[model samples]
Target: MLAIRKATVADCELIHTLAWQTFPETYKDILSPEQSEYMMEWMYSLENLRKQMEEEGHIYFIAYHNDEACGYVSIQQQGENLFHLQKIYVLPSFRGVHCGSFLFHEAVRYIKEIHPTPCVMELNVNRNNKALKFYEHMGMRIVREGDFPIGNGYYMNDYIMELEID
Candidate 1:
């Protein structure tokens, strides 16, 4: 069984590796390799993860199967009623399993506990990713679609999906 829990600074390197490994599949077609590489190092660097984990707006978590880390998800709170799912990933071998769902459930559960009324959960997925259908199946609506500016010359054509809890 896979377990989900808060991630610690000690897990940074593994998380970075996992993010890079999973990211290309998620963005390579939607974004240039240069942009993906830039975004990966800029967004998943050890120092960046360290600060994000230490802060409140960002929530980091790890999925463990028999005590070995296999995946992670990061949620960024925007306001009293808005939370953005910054990233979610699982190692290739663990993809068919519920590792991603386990981490996602943690984010949902946390939002439920932290907010009195149902809040909004948002995320962006590349236009070509079939996972957008999965998000829609999870009840996330297509709120908007736009170009996502990741530093450097890379941009992503993504759908801004939102789920409103009621």
Candidate 2:
């Protein structure tokens, strides 16, 4: 069985460890080693994670399979009715077991409870990511494309996808 629980600031280390392990696996094919290393420090550093959870109001959830942590997801409110799905990842070994879907639905459920009606959830996925079809399968459509610079000359070439919450 798959279960997901809200993550607290205390779980930062665990999340960081998972990010370090799974990120490379996910981006190894699309990103060079230097780029991946830079991104890991830029996004998953303990200080940044703390800032995201503490100051930015980003909510995170960890997914577990049979009591073992396997994935995580995070979301942050972007506006009155807009929530950004900032992150969603499942360990490679857990990929086929619907862990990502579980985390995605959890984020949606949380958004519905916190946000008002007529809300929408958005996320940016790399243009070359294999998860593009998976996001589509989950009812998201690419609304636009962007090349966001994240320092050190690195840019996130992504498709900005959104799903309306009914």
Candidate 3:
């Protein structure tokens, strides 16, 4: 059976591996080959992930199966009650296994446990992505449109979607 939990320091290495695999594959068509590689390096580098873990209001997690990390998500509770889901990724081989959906569902549950007031979860998703449809299917709605400036010619055109948890 699969399990979802808050990621510990020991899970960092595995989370790095998952990010390396999932990010590039998912952005293959949406980004130039070079741009994708650059963004992956910047985002998934161990140093950045480590620093993010120490930041205030940050909650990151990993999904596992028999102790192997299959996916991860990083979120930030930025201002008032909005949780910014910075990244959510599952291994390529794990797609259609419901790991992504499982991660998303667990995220909602986790937020409910922490926030006393209504919590809003937001994520940036590519406009043409099939994952966008999946998000809608998951009951998230489009709150706005925006661009994620990842630098090095890697700005992403995405929908800023949100889900409100009571």
Candidate 4:
């Protein structure tokens, strides 16, 4: 069985740990080692995670399977009717299971719970990421693509995918 809990500021470290374990592996084939390390520090640093939850309004959820932490997801409202699926990652060992889907649906549930109306959920995925199919399977469609600069001369060449919730 899969369960999800709303994460608190106290869980920042756990999220950081999960990011370290999963993010690199997720992008290993698409990102260089230097770029991956840069992104890890830039996005998953403990301070950054806390800032995201506290100041940035990113609500995070931790997913568990059989009492073991397996994945996490986060959502941030960007507009009155627009939300961003900022992060969704599942550990490699948990891939075959429904961890990713659970997290994805939980993110949408959170958005709908708070907004309770029509909205759009958007997520930026690397153009080469295998998860592109997963997002598409979840009913997201690529609306655009671009090379977003992420500092240190690194660029995230990605496709912006969006799902309309009604």
RMSD of 2: 0.7
TM-score of 2: 0.98
User: TM-score rank, highest first?
Assistant: 4, 2, 3, 1
What C-alpha lDDT, on a 0 to 100 scale, does residue 163 get in candidate 2? 100
Candidate 3 residue lDDT tens string, 41-136: 777788777777775556788888677788988888887888988888889888878888888888888888888679789988989787898889
Pairs clashing in candidate 2? none
Clashes found in each candidate (C-alpha, N, C closer than 3 A): 0, 0, 0, 0
RMSD for each model, in Å, please? 1.7, 0.7, 1.5, 0.6
Show model 4 residue runs off by greater than 4 Å: none
User: TM-scores, in order shown?
Assistant: 0.90, 0.98, 0.92, 0.98
Question: Considering summed lDDT, which 10 consecutive residues are worst modelled in model 2?
Answer: 111-120
Q: What local distance difference test score does each model get?
A: 0.82, 0.94, 0.83, 0.94
lDDT of 2 by residue, 20-85 (tens): 889999999999999999999987999989999999999999999999999999999989888999
Candidate 1: regions farther than 4 A off: none
Regions more than 4 Å wrong, model 3: none
